[model samples]
Target: MMILVTGGARSGKSRHAEALIGDSSQVSVYRYLANP
Candidate 1:
């Protein structure tokens, strides 16, 4: 599933994205996509 999140700078976008992920292993993978 694709979740598109839009917000201003320092709006907790990354933190929110991390929350959407399941756990630690999932985090590494998703963080890659989230940041890239």
Candidate 2:
């Protein structure tokens, strides 16, 4: 499964995602793709 979150900088998307997945002892690996 995968979730994609996108928004302007400092838009709190990350925080919201974390909150949505809170209280779960599951394993989640984050993959970051940086464009240079």
All models, RMSD in angstroms:
4.9, 2.5
The reply for model 1, stretches above 4 Å from the true place, is: 23-36
lDDT of 2 by residue, 1-36 (tens): 567877877788778678656745687755544458
**Candidate 1 lDDT, tens digit per residue, 1-36?**
566767877888778877777544432445433344
The Cα local distance difference test for each model comes to 0.63, 0.68
lDDT of 2: 0.68
| lDDT value, candidate 1, whole model | 0.63
For lDDT, the strongest prediction is 2
Cand. 2 TM to true fold: 0.52
Give candidate 2 misplaced runs (Cα > 4 Å). Answer: 23-25, 31-36
